[model samples]
Target: MTSLVVPPSTLGSSFFSWFASSSSNNSLNPPKIFRKTPSNAVALYPISLKSSNRPSFDRFPRTKIWATLGEKDPNGAAPLQVVEESSSSIVDEEVEKSVKVLKDAAKTRRVAAEEVLSALSVLEKAKLDPSKFFNTLGGTSSPGRTWMLIFTAEKKLEKGRYFPLTAIQRFDAAGKRIENGVFLGPIGSLTFEGRMSWKNRILAFIFERIRIKFGPLEPLEISLGKKDEREPSSKDPFFIWFYVDEELAVARGRSGGTAFWCRCRRVNT
Candidate 1:
């Protein structure tokens, strides 16, 4: 036999060709390779081969995998999850704050209503005292004029006090001091007579029957009584009537063809 000697170049080329052919065939039926080196024992490695045009390893280690998956920066997928949680927490806090504000406002309104009721109670109590009562009368017109008739109860009693129990005062249309006097005890009745002039007689007629309301106390109904022909008057006749409360507490005195028509009430302090 001829002496067989393997050249280094031929051995290297043959190893490469065998590797390629084995790789191509191994694509359909993948092979398990076992290599024994001088220092290491048997090392088993699995090599998956694809088409020759493709990369040697079917799937290679991906570069910067975590970065590509958005996991390394503040704006990454994990950071987005944290942001969503934080945003939800903030919205919940705001909702709770708004609820608290509404509750506080409702409580304040209730307290205010209670305070108003307390004030009204005090005012109502003050109105019950007869001694604290005072009456004021006034009238107004264009180029307006106003008159005030005040009546205050006396603190002490004396001899002359019983004789003239009440007092009376008169004011002119100009609101200037015209007359002031006292009603004698034997006078029996008092009367205030006047005429209301208007460009339209119909207005005066309607106004003559108007009613004055006093908050839950009573209503004073004004009506025409009799026409006094003797007194020279304008087209609007002298409308006469007695003022009285619904409860009839301060009623007009009816005796000796005389009637007391003025009505009075206690004022709330």
Candidate 2:
């Protein structure tokens, strides 16, 4: 039910008195007021004039409205510090997950090629700091020095295949030494030992000696013996490391080929 109450101040005492007198002399009915409710039904209110010629209104229930304050507000913007912290956390988690997948693929070699490629892409896009790589890959620690090539991707990174031959690489951060070897079961083996320089994510190396063995013959060593004493630079054959952990590593060579390696037992030259 709805009603409209007119104030005494709006309708003066003289008007109220005149209306009361006219109502007493003749029967009069006040207009009915209608209000539309939520159910679409019309509610009517009957108006009655009291002896004092005053009007009254019936009270209806009020709809309660509530508002929540503080950071939980959906319409509010998040603080910059919180946003940045969350974003960095997500990036770290993605890098960690990708690294795990890559390591698993390297060890088991059972993961699908497409999935491995995707994981490699994720790590490369992460662009994580190279400091850990330098220490863990070249530092003189249990898993630091030796790694065996497991898979290689072409320059376009569209397809990858496992190396048909056994190949291993070693790095010594303290001495900045690099060594590479290829074994052919008992048939023969070839080894290249060299000096390397590390700059950021790239490890540039130049071989100084070559060791070759065939059949049962003794291994022969030969030195290129370059007179230059300069250190290897970016101009030399280099590898740009994308990720390196205790178990696995992924890097791109100067020839634009990408490869993943598994940590292997260290061997002496």
Clashes of 1: 0
What is residue 28's positional error in candidate 2, in angstroms?
A: 99
lDDT tens digits, residues 179-216, model 2?
A: 77654433555667778888888988887887887646
In angstroms, give how far residue 267 of model 2 lies from its true place. 4.1
Q: How many pairs in model 2 have backbone atoms within 3 A of each other, for residues 3 or more apart or on separate chains, i.e. clashes?
A: 0
- Which regions in candidate 1 have their CA more than 4 angstroms from the true location? 1-144, 150-193, 196-212, 216-220, 228-269
Worst 10 residues of 1 by lDDT: 10-19
Residue pairs in collision within model 2:
none
Tens digits of per-residue lDDT for model 1 on 109-180?
222333323322222222222211111122232212211111111111111000112222222222311222
